[model samples]
Target: MERKYFDCLIQAIDLINDGIHIVDRSGKIVYYNAAAKRLDEIDVDKAIGRHILEVYPSLTFDTSTLIKVLNTGNPIFNIEQNFINYKGDKISTINSTLPIIYNNKIVGAMEVSRNITEVRVLSEKIINLQRELYETNNTSVEKIKKPKAHYTFIDIIGQSKEMLKLKTLGLKAAMSDSPVMVCGNTGTGKELFVQSIHNSSNRKNKPFIAQNCAALPSNLLESILFGSVKGSFTGAENRPGLFELANNGTLFLDEINSMPLELQAKLLRVLQDGRIRRVGSSNTIDVDVRIISAINIDLNEVIESKQLRQDLFYRLNVITLIIPDLSKRKEDISILIDYFIKKYNDKCKKFFNGVSKEVLDIFMDYSWPGNVRELEHAIESAISLYDGDIIREEHLPFQFKNFHPTKNFTLDTNVIQPLNTAVEKVEKEIITSALEQTDYNISKAAKIINVPRQTLQYKIKKLDIPFK
Candidate 1:
């Protein structure tokens, strides 16, 4: 290529967020962008013209994607590769390598790699957190202080038809020992459902532990789930994992989709045999722990994305509960508002009697992406901000004050639809329009529509609203 064209190409590739690496047919590094250098921890001046294997000693001709593509004249798309650099620092990446052919002759290979080192680090930290949360000695369980479960089915606030159906299913599931999976958007009271089930289950008196899977990584998560032996690794002590700690009780895994795929396979094994093998132990121990898992996203989407293992999903999904969005249960919003007003009234020592009609209309029209959690926060915000007995529109958050309906739809006069059907259609259209306006930014869209972000998120999930 010409010098200006080459420079232009370099600048264009440099603009990309992911690493770009290119090598000649001879496996000599020809191009390495700044992103590639940063991701691979290599110097651009030194890497260009050097052999691929020379720069990354950990990779061989057989293992290197660039070399494989160059020799085979075949592309390797979206494959995860892990290697250590010359400095012995481990790097993980998802790479797409393609052969650069000229005149039907393989001339070189180009690789696009995205670094996932932070994900690995995050997972490791999560494992450590799990160990701390479920700390236990080999002989006895560690006494980490945990709050007692205060809310049961009675505490589950909504009484809408959908809510009633969900509660009925939850109560029935609580009677059994099978794994349960609860799916809903954020702030949909997933923990409340899990707590209610635990409180109602036969294992209510026993330990009822809950942990968010996103908080830890796979290796540490594994050690925390299935106890670790003293010599499992350096500083590894005889610690009982969550499974052992919650034996004959309930273990609630929140955001279960966040658990690593490989670790999920192990979880499936444990569920199958009612047995758990410590991180580095040979013997298997039996633990009759009822598992309850929750996910903020659609389970099908998670499974398709390979975040949640299919078999494990099926196991946990033997009994599944899909929580309704706040929009679908709008009837409960007034009740919830009243309940929260009383709640914050006592906590903040205020005498707020109710919300103004204008505020109520805004609440009804708003799409709560954050669901109940968001609603509670909105009420609390208004209560804390206002001194008067009534919560006026001015006391509401800026999101509500600046709220604007994105669109208005009119049903064809020639066609008549049922009142309920027509109302649902309008609701769906309004939400869909807002999502498009904000490019599907739940928080922004929620604010635009004067509802909590979680409530809006729940509506999206419940209404099957799709966005990129």
Candidate 2:
């Protein structure tokens, strides 16, 4: 080629954004474009005599294939790998190389490449989305539109007659498309029923999200259950809420009785309308989310007293389920004890064959105010302490160690414990169990308990539970 034509070609090469490299059949650098040279900080004018690998050590790879391409006088496409340039910035690229054949003999390999860093990044994002889709299906956590309960029907480990009845109802509820109201005392695993309903539902393929209606402030809760548009409020990121996110799925609203009257009305509207508008926007986005609500408080009182809207109560009570307290389900204690033993055996790296009969007797006799969740934590704690496969009474936490099954056998006496003492006991149980489960992260503990950071801090102070 003439010098003028070569200069014109160089100008054309300079216009390309992606790197380009040209190597002669002798494996020496012949024509590396401005972009390609920029990638390696190599001056093409001074690079004419050097071998491709000698110039860029990072570009050196399986050369047998390249040699084959050259020897066969053919083109190769999409040679893929990670590339670290002269500046040490990692880049991903796909190289398409063609042998610039002359008189049927390969003279050089002209390689064109596109930086696939963004493409790879986009591909990773797609993989994450797919994982989120599949992982949500596989995890032990209940599928929900909110952040209420982590457990589902399977996670509720018990074989008592009462538990079996609850399970039957839960499975039947899961098969139905109607709204389900789960009633239980605080920490009684009402949310578990909600999750079981969702996991077993027809829409299990979609997301299962949950939220505590009474947890967030009315405005924040409204925005969370519905959604808020961009510029809806100061510093708002314009995110969609549970209703839109749970479309084609289930939404578990925990502590439903605690929901404010105004939001209860809004919820009733969504239940009837099947559509949600952003907090400050008028555009109504339709949704198809099943409702599975749980309440620690009595809904009858809530509705009768007008604390909760009567109309909303009637609407949501299409298929109501009253979860029996742990005290009433003594039949399932041994099964649950063994289940948690097996669970924490792997988690705590301890070989716990099973709970001692002594431990099982105490567990069966104890009136669990906190229900299945409390038992799970108790067993987890026992596993952490007990070195042997058999979980003895000594391996149990301090409270359980001194806990006499006959101490609070009466419901009247059990229901009247001092709030401060009760809080301390619950806090100790939750903290010790959380540590045993996560090896102790205060942040994770706070998250599991679903308390505010400051609230958790206060609880830690009040309980005198050291967070290590």
Candidate 3:
């Protein structure tokens, strides 16, 4: 039965996509799975029972993670390693090596490796091509045309006091060369503010490059941001990172909280002295770029969770600008709606004067979790579906249907009531509709209306609404 179990485990390990290699404490290869054979381009019969150094001549005792684990009885995880196999071919892999202990004694070590040679090669090629294009364009033209920032302060649409204050602060931040941090919820046009800052800054004529930190993995993102030297890793070529490309202008890093902590330390060094070293190179290059980073969530929460390094945050947060959510700035709803309507009308070539009273009331009452972007999309969708002179509740998106006003309150302009009474009535109606739609499930109802569950519960009690 023990032999059967061992065979079953071996079969499972052999079928996996990652290479598995096990070595005894003496460093003899005991098990080399099929994936290991393919990744190293070695024959199974030649690898098994041979010393690790004999199988891969390029690996030394100090350089091999597997051998280190065996000697130290410590584990090493997710480390990128580049080495030459017995076939004299360069290989790159992310390897995690673990020590196998039996009866409180280290018996063997096993390594699981995911091949990333192709991915590394392809990414390097892309960087090289981009560098070639940049150099060609710059040298070919007498008047070099740098990347432009399309938006300016005037393009920002808002009249609310909060927005006005934010814009004023943004303009001030633009004047300084300090690293600025923009905080706002998703879809609040963080990029718009970023571009506006760059266009208004002293380095406006230089390149303005933007990269979302969450868009790529740690390894790829590191290479793309810091660049790589030829032979740094297998298939790596000379290439410049975003820092070099945006040397004289701005490097806008969106979702900065998503960057890896190790990389953040590297970034902190750059921010400290304006110097950066490409991957696998000892040479340091000076950069004159200003960094403008943006995060979608609360600052304190990410710092507490350790998703972002506090030291790096402090360096980048020298000039912090927090944009208010749409719900907090309700006064701008009508203005934003009108702007979106006119803007879409010109684009769609449809004449949409404005939304009807019922639609307007619903728009004002609904919680826009997606913020201004959502409102614009809702208007555009309504315009596309209906070719009427004015948009009505029926023309709006399906989400707005849950916010239809109750019959007790008339939406007519002639009907007047106290503001508090009218607001309470509308809130009750919308909450009740969300509850019914979610079958009395408070969590689901809150999610449908895009409010916190606790807030929904408080509203339920305040409004005296019944639920199962």
Candidate 4:
């Protein structure tokens, strides 16, 4: 009894967190642990002192795995096997094998395993969320206001051909005193280009001011651009306008096409004559401010519609620079992807291995309507949703399945078909079928039509199609 007690105490010294097992030279299981037989419903006492292969004769179970690690003097990790249970169902498990060394002699080896079935299931969910986020941001990328930053010309990234072309035009425009007009799709970094021009010009040291003409009321905009004398209507205070502050520098106007028609006439005079009159003041202020205006919408169309003054359009459009959309610049996507990934990773204080090839392939496929701004947010969201050390296909957001930028260069198939008089035509046939399916409720009918509610209402009014 005392001898058996001493043996148990000696064996207890070799116990470890990881499961341990010992086999004799003849391959007999002399000792094993409760943890070793954890997967099976077998009794640990019965599992002990049995032939290793005969003990757990499950499918794909290898007796030689531990022997191999023992002989190699190295550890084997993450070996996968579908172990058939007593009821004959496969259970996923990952095993780690390590050699046991005793006084410079190879004894036996032990194996440890962990179940990863739950983790695989969770990864599927994270991938789906990643896709949903990408789709949600795609439609609203431009409408959201970006966080204000103190970035200047140097902060603008890229030396790509498209950006360099804009830079050359900007440099030339900045050298001259002509009013500059920058045209681009919304969120194409128009402000960055404007600041670049200002930084390159001789007026680099002076104050550079920027404002969106479309974002403010006309009365407030007038005071902001042309200054306001004391007692100039409500919130009256003596203050310098953008023209005064930007004297010897540049004043950048964003969405200039949205500037009210009445204000455009006043802006035209300021451009024609380098003089501006303060509100409620008779004296004209002599300011040498350079003018730079940006518009996503074509000002010529606004001029034709009489929404903008023709004279003001011509004056501001003297030197025009059109920024190509992100879809047009496919070569820059990879560089920009890495840039934003690194940016957000540092800002969020998370570590993510680079995106998998599958994810990169999807990114290359998407048509970016919202331009660079859209791409940046998509990358940020992907990184936030990624689970593993690396971002994979599951890590990427959706819309990539159908996204093709090169295909977007061609004619858009989703184009609205003009009014169809006959019910036999495609548009008419589809709409009538949708309306019939919806039972003729206009609200429900418009959703069934897959067209905008406002558009469907206009079509109904135009075609005299009755809907309850």
Best by lDDT: 3
Ranking according to TM-score, highest score first: 3, 1, 2, 4
List the lowest-lDDT window of 10 residues for candidate 3: 403-412
Q: Candidate 1, which segments miss by more than 4 Å at Cα?
A: 60-63, 68-74, 86-88, 138-155, 199-289, 295-314, 342-351, 365-369, 384-387, 402-468
> What is the number of residue pairs that collide in model 2?
13
Off by over 4 Å in 4: 1-160, 385-387, 397-468
Tell me the spans in candidate 3 whose CA falls farther than 4 Å from its real position: 1-68, 82-96, 108-143, 215-217, 342-351, 383-398, 401-468
Model 3 whole-model lDDT (C-alpha atoms)? 0.85
lDDT of 2 by residue, 333-363 (tens): 7777777777888788887788777777777
Q: Where does model 2 exceed 4 Å of error?
A: 1-154, 405-468
- Reference-based lDDT, residue 88, model 2: 64
TM-score of each model, paired residue for residue = 0.67, 0.54, 0.77, 0.53
RMSD, candidate 3, Å? 5.5
TM-score, model 1 to reference: 0.67
Tens digits of per-residue lDDT, candidate 4, 368-412, equal: 657899888777877777655666665554634333222212323
Count clashing pairs, candidate 3. 0
Candidate 4, residue 411: the lDDT equals 29
RMSD each, Å: 8.1, 20.0, 5.5, 28.8
